[model samples]
Target: MPIQASFPSQEPLGLNADLIRKYNQPAPRYTSYPTALKFKPIEDKASRSAMLADIEDAEGPLSLYVHVPYCRSLCWFCGCAKIISTNTALADKYLDYLEMEVRRYANLIRSGRKVVQLHFGGGSPNFLSPAQIGRLDNILRSSFEFDPSAEISVELDPRTLSKSQVLAFRKLGVNRASIGVQDINSKVQEAIHRIQPTETNIKTISWLREAGINSINVDLIYGLPHQTESSFNQTLDEVLGYDPNRLAVFSYAHVPWSKPAQKILERSPLPTADSKIDILIQTVQRLTGSGYAHVGMDHFAKIDDPMVKAQEAKTLQRNFQGYSLHADVEICAFGMSAISQSKNSFRQNQKDLDAYYKMLDEGDIPLEKGYLLTPDDQIRREVIMRLMCDLELDFQARGESNGVDFQNYFSSELDRLQVFEEDGLISFVEGGLEVTPLGRLLIRNVASRFDAYLGDAKQGFSKAI
Candidate 1:
């Protein structure tokens, strides 16, 4: 199932500003269908237990998402669910509650399913000491089985990440590491209040490579305050010199309502909308020109990168933690604010630490809100994911696989897509829909057409651009 992706191999992606501005509306990232914004309050324990039963009966491995929400300090530019504290003792206590939460799930998730993928995301997973990281790993291993070659990855903050911690990560079977190099320019760093010089990232990468963990990923952000195209190109040049295995060049989403820390950034002048677009266009051109294969939606990988392999083989998937290689693996997440994704449902842990601990102390899973997938949701999920990951959708083949006439069933949606086609963002092929290079930048807008619940509901999603 080689999904046809006509994205240019090394050529710079061309941009049409008129099309970009028209489609630069707010839209879900399609990381999960029905979107996290649709999650409702869990009715009772039955709903949760039923989801756990589905996970147990499901016939595949699991993907574990361990959220360590603690951070050493505040980066005003960040919008993640993070708790700022310099107190290391708080993390040790958090771990105790985390183990209890995992145990509660383990008692209910009584199955032989193993973990094929494991990701550690956070304010910063490296906020913990080496011993704490080891303890966290031990807690997870005791509850669930992990495949021998599981794709284990962690997010690191070079400022806080230590060589000893990197060694422990390698010893504990982590093969991939992603560090944030969100504009190494001193002024940008000062604006964000996270003063990490490029030397920090270099030292961190050296430690990781020395520990035999070489699948490196670096995250870059556009649309930051005082970011010019030239300034960002300098950052890109510095990062390209490192030759990362993969790159996630994301557009900054400034949502002050959800993340109060972001309001502080108002003191700094942000790049104008036009300036942001220029930065985005040049970033795409630079990465593609430098021989990195542009994987869907802000991610770029080397031709030999596993992510590129997954995209080519049609196994690439989007999740709460962005893109993943395993589409079938159900996610069982632990820790505060962590989201758990089952075959037909999604649930998140309590976000507040006190509330999270209270639920754990009561010997219950700290479930906050969740959404169950309808049958229509399941079908649409596959359809939208194919469009998102493979960058195309085969009507005939997908019709057979999904047991519906894709053309007839989605007739109205196809009609809606015509506006994009007219705008030159997408095109209709012989038996499928293909996103043109121009459309790739606004892929969310194209994927949004297939969303059943997107009925003029503003889900507070970031702009499609």
Candidate 2:
């Protein structure tokens, strides 16, 4: 089914400042329903082991995530789990432990379970040397049967990413590369402590394409301190000149409560919520008008990109990594703070590197927290993910399949949605619900209505805007 292309609409989201101010509140990005905030401490290693056991019997292909947590220096705006060190030797040591962790899981995963998707994400996967990248790739290939057409991808920091490293990655069969440009403005770069030159970014993209890594993605950020509309527009223009296959225009989620490094931003004049919303509006208009398809939720893709195809087909999926085209594969992640999701459970590796190493040295899974989805959690996840990805829900059909009454099962939640309905964010469509074009900008706000745990949590997450 071709994805309904009603979005990327020339029409505005109709989200005025007052409406945005009223609705802009802390909400989960819905990368996963019952977001990480709801995860409980894993009381026993056996629970994780049992999850591994299920993977052994599962018949589907796998998605492997390897987290590389080392960065040469800190990008103060970074919210990801990372360790900053100038020492290259640390990567070699980290790789040894990472290899051991992969081998440990390889023993549990069935031999024939082909890896269909492999992603290397981190503080910066580029932190590793060419030789180190080669070693990691070899270790993984030797341990698992990878599909010949597996989608192998890696995230890189363009500042330190070298052409030699890019070539090595290409030789290792990396078909996709995501580079962090963040912002090309000099002031924004200095403020964020990520001083990457525009020439470097253009060269990085050029090298990736020359290496035959055709699916290139460049990331741009809005709402950073020192970001003006003109500066951001210049950054966007510079990025567009590279003509990346995909663009991830993300809002700078300032959660100083969770990431103390972001506290530095408090000292600077960050954009107001109203201004941030304006930047978002500008982003949508620029990208969509430039012939890129808004793939929803901070992503834009060229018309022929697979992500656009997936969105059209309704097969697009969301995960901890943000958006993915591979929906059926179970993800098995290695390294500190990495999350592994299977059909029955979600598990995370220890967040502390020393603790993770200690646990793995003792021959344990190094898992710290996770959630085993209840039947109810699974059902709610379905509802949340659909509204999030497809922007529509067929309540009666979903209820029939899940063996629950559409309206009765969610009476209170539906009652809450009445406000949004009244506000024109959503409407009843074919006995179900659909997010209006005006509501697409506030999709997270719409999806949050289906969350069962939001009411009980007091922890502050990032704002929806």
Q: Rate the local accuracy (lDDT) of all candidates.
A: 0.87, 0.83
Candidate 1: segments with Cα more than 4 A from true spot? 1-3, 6-8
Q: Which residue pairs collide, candidate 1? A: none
Q: For model 2, how does the per-residue alpha-carbon lDDT over 372-405 read when each residue is reduced to its tens digit?
A: 7888988888788877777777777679868999
Please write out the lDDT profile of model 1 over residues 113-192, one tens digit for every residue. 88899999998988888899899989999998999999999999999888999998887799999999899899999999
Best by lDDT: 1
How good is model 2 by TM-score?
0.95
For model 2 the local lDDT of residue 33 reads: 70
Candidate 2: the clashing residue pairs are 3-312
Q: Residue 408, candidate 2: how far off, in angstroms?
A: 3.1
lDDT for model 1, please. 0.87
